[model samples]
Target: MTDQPSTDRLSEARAALATAMALHEQGDLEGAEAGYRAVLALEYRATDVLPLLAGLLGRLSRAEDALIAWEQLLAIAPDHAVALHEKGLTLHWLGRTGEAVAALEQACALDPHNAIAIGNLAVVLADAGRNHAAIGQFRRALALQSDNLHLRHQLRRLGAASVPFWHIPMMNDAPRNDAFEAAITAAIAVAGPDARVLDIGAGSGLLSLIAARAGAQHVVACEMEPLIAEMAQQIVAQNGYADRITVHAKPSTDLAVGVELDVPAQILVSEILSSDLLTEKVLDTFEDAHRRLLAPDALVIPRAATAMGCLVASETLADYAFVGEVSGFDLSPFTDFAQQRLPIHGTMTAWQRLSDDHELVRLDLTQAKHDAVLTRLRIPVTASGRAIGIVQWMHIDLWPGVTFDNHPDRYTDGGWLQILHSFPTPVDVIAGETLDIAVGHDRITLILLPLTQ
Candidate 1:
């Protein structure tokens, strides 16, 4: 380290570097790049000159050449934080996602406290579709640079890309929260203070905190998203319940009975139902919990969930589900590729119910096993129009005498929104006709479509 020449110790190299920097600042990029290369070839301050040359190359859209310059600098100093960080950015520009992530990850490791480096790593990870890891890195960067709006914007943009926009509003739903709190309080009451509780999908640690506040001593919670899990841990600790609740950054299926938990939990409280009720993988997570992470008789919150819906007709929703007769052409076949399901504010959106609400699908969470269910249900039409699809919502049986639903009729302004399951093509129906529809789930998604027969 002492043998390393400081800028003041290198008279000739420092003068050359000054001239190169002047050329760079004066927008003589070509001249600057060549000067930097000439200095590096002289065995001058390569560490200094390489950065300029690499950055100039990148600016000139020579990302591959910039990458080479960065690699050369890295060879001389493998742990150089700037080299790794710039190399990562260059790799990202070149669409080398894997290499970008590797470089950025190494940069973050070398300069753990550098928020910019961490943020760059997060960006690369997100582009690579490793969203969970990317979120964690952005959160870490945000923690370091709290007032950075750009970082905050990136976090929100990436978050929206990864999660549903309703999550924030859903967390703000006092009715939904109260239902879970009451159920959790009751579950803890039945299981006793010492009963261990497992909260799968502990987003914001709300359920776990409710369990802790209800006097449950040991609560183990797992969230698949690393960033949310970390935030949950922080929120739990901030509220002084860290001692009672442990948050694990993993999916419940990855949890081992004695490893991540001191034994199978006695009570399971999870709020993971999607609008359609299965897209969040609640069935898979809960079944795994029952098999490996929960006590044989563990009380499950939301013991059951049902997808309830009715036939609907709406031009507003129809526009979203179908497109045809654009200006003056028949492109009706494109409807085959239209979105199958769409989420909308049921009360806010104009829709006419053609039939009374019917049960579409139900899941018994208390049961340890579940298979894909497909059944033919008949919807007796009461009003007739162009039947776009079924507008569906959820009815969650949280506990005895405590239930919640985002019923499309009276329920408005909550985290939940009614989802429209569009048909392959709009079907015209008349009153007093029963629409035979295939209504069930394929284990992971709800099956709601009108049957041709």
Candidate 2:
């Protein structure tokens, strides 16, 4: 190249870079992107400019382009922490969780003190369902910045996600525990010490401990939540049942006949029922156990669960269930965003049931498979008022002699609460009338709707 031409090319590159920066500041993203591309074509500080271009692409919601730009930057500066972190975030947004984790791990390794990178790594790990590794990353981040609220929240969320929903209330209710233990002890006498026990959803490893205390010889337990699994491990050791019970930190879906257990269990005990029957994926979990994890004719604990609820009318709750015009504005349309389900502490909340208790849904836990379900029914109103929603509870048949429930009428001070399944809109109902409703499961969620009547 001639000296004169090289000088002209350098000047042009500098001018393009300056114009790009100015346009970027003015929020003219398209103009800025064009100028940056022109500068990059001249190969002037391409590594530095690449990150800038990638960031702009991300802000523009052009994730795929952003990812490509970041990957190119990484090719030039392989250990660049920021590039790795950005690339990982982009990958995660693209739903490529495994690659996202690998990139974030590299970022964390290169910059061990970068709390942001560590936090991102933890999140992607959790998204990939590697809760144990996610917990480790969270703990490492916490060790560096103990007072980080975001990290603490993540740790607690993961911990809670691991525990079965029923465990919280069961832990809180001493009376219920006593009743269940008494019934379990009786059943163990009939099942005998030689029974091969399987405890699914082993929250704090309590049920397995109970079985051990009742003299069962072999016990296998599986917990879907990692934090809870760790806690259950500790509790089992403390209770001296570690030798008898083997706790697997995985869902029932991961268990196998000859792998996790010596064989399919003879007495299957799982306490995974949510306050609302279908919300916890209990139907799927139980079916998997019956089909693969348990032997034929295995004695399943909580043999069946029924979702019991009563229609409710409350002016206090109507404001929560619906939105309407106020102060001369047409704001009623905001009601479309009302919550489908609201968790309420049964004893703490002041609300009245307006109809007789009815069965909303029932799950037979012993079934080998369950088809997706939605059904329509009519609920009679006992009082004349604005019907806001339905307050629902659970009834569990733990074993032949054992049973437990969080009845909205009398149960108090439990971790599990009677949830308020709100209607899409407030409906005016007269005393002694009926409201037609639709109820079912969308595989992973419970569906409740008040039909037009």
Q: Give the Å error, residue 205, model 1.
A: 1.6
- Ten contiguous residues with the weakest lDDT in model 2: 1-10
lDDT (Cα, tens digit) per residue for candidate 2, span 1-453: 123337788899889999999999999999999988998888777887898899999999999999999998988899999999999999999999999999999999999998889998999999998877888899899999999999999998987775557576678688666656665566678778877888888887877888889888888888877777878888898888888988888888888878988877878776666666676778778888788877797777777888788888776667777878889888988888888788776666777777889888877877888787999979888887777888898888777766788887678677667888988776788778888889877767677788973
Question: lDDT score, residue 154, model 1?
Answer: 88
Local accuracy of candidate 1 as per-residue lDDT tens digits, 24-80: 999999988877876775577778778889989988999889999999999999999
* Top of the candidates by TM-score: 1
Model 1 Cα displacement at 411 (Å)? Answer: 1.0
Q: Clash pairs of candidate 2?
A: 162-225, 169-415, 302-398
Overall lDDT per candidate, in order of appearance: 0.88, 0.82
Report how far off residue 234 is in candidate 2 (Å). 2.7
Tell me the lDDT of candidate 2.
Answer: 0.82
Those runs of model 2 whose alpha carbons end farther than 4 Å from true positions after fitting are: 1-131, 138-169, 369-380, 435-452
